[model samples]
Target: MAKPMRRLMNPALFICDLQEKFRPAIYEYPKVIATTQKMLKACKILNIPVFATTQNKSRLGETCEELGLDSPDGISTKVHADKTAFSMWTPEVRKAFADLPPTTPPTAKRECIIVGIESHICVTQTTLDLLREGHKVYVLADGVSSCNREEVPIALARLRAEGAVVTTSESWMYECMGDAGIQEFKEIAKLVKETKDSTQQSLQTLCKI
Candidate 1:
């Protein structure tokens, strides 16, 4: 089982294969993008380090603007790693992890909260690798998707079976926030509201279809 996250300490947000060209190919792409933004907002408020990867930028294109790797919401502390391997543990990704933000102590035990595309492939592979390397891994359900809807749940269950905690974006956000009295609660709450609003809009858009 993945270790319970009690506080927002020594944690990193790892985004994998959230490329642009693949958006249309994935299930619930808009919600995936929105949920990721909410998580990014939480990361910013809590000062969590963010490491993102592009799975072959040339073919897959760059991380979507919604994920904000190119220009984030004042959270300047982001690492954009490029890779070919299905796992984020590849040499290039490792280099990004190696030089974490100065605020994060190198010796502290690291827990990674992950999100991204192709839950059956890249996301699953990366989660498995993180677990093997002794990092507590949590996969955000709403933040990851696949080309096939059926495969998404299967991949999430498989990750959970392999010891990675399967959670939703809101669930993880509040868990990390801990209590409403904490400083970032308002910020996260605001972000949550925005996400809800955005999701509502999306649902309406879908209803028109």
Candidate 2:
């Protein structure tokens, strides 16, 4: 049988609800954070716009603390959309997002690459909504998390069935790069190799009974 393939085009980046009080509980917190930062770095180099959404600021606070978005110039905190719905298209969110002032109207909108926590809830709904709105959505699996492992697989299946492309941070990097022959590729390759080495070490330590 032939496997499925996704061809991503003109994708921006969106990160949702990887909040402060909740991040540590996820199965792959460190990998999610590191991979997200790598994606942000790749986006920056590629000149891609990035947006981040938070669930509730009063309870969760900003996304920077959760994602460790510590840049001297700051993490490019656009208007943080606080939402009650899992979907980010609430009135408040729509208003906050409208602060960006698009150069063109609805049909010309750009695609967004999304990542975040609680895969079965906020991440799932937001992606579904985005897809409905005719935006190409790329879900970064390694850059996303759920409170339980079971939710992750379920969320992935739901999103894939709904037309979202499920991809990892490294695959996203190379996909965005399109070729392994650029100067930036060297840095990304080093990062990927390091990540592989770290996973191997962790697995080896686990096997050393």
- Angstrom error of the Cα, residue 117, model 2: value is 1.1
Over 1-209, each residue of candidate 1 has an lDDT whose tens digit, in order, gives 55343465678888887888988888788877777777777887888888888888988787887666657354554567788888877876777777775433555657789888888899999998889888889897777878877887788778999999887777778877666777767888888787887656534432222
Cα lDDT of model 2 by residue, 57-84, tens digit: 7886666563445456445545456666
Best model number under TM-score: 1
- Which portions of model 1 show Cα errors greater than 4 Å? 1-6, 72-74, 101-108, 199-209
| Shift in Å, residue 135, candidate 1 | 1.0
Q: Please state the error at residue 199 of candidate 1 in Å.
A: 5.3
Q: What local lDDT score does residue 87 receive in model 1, on the 0 to 100 scale?
A: 82
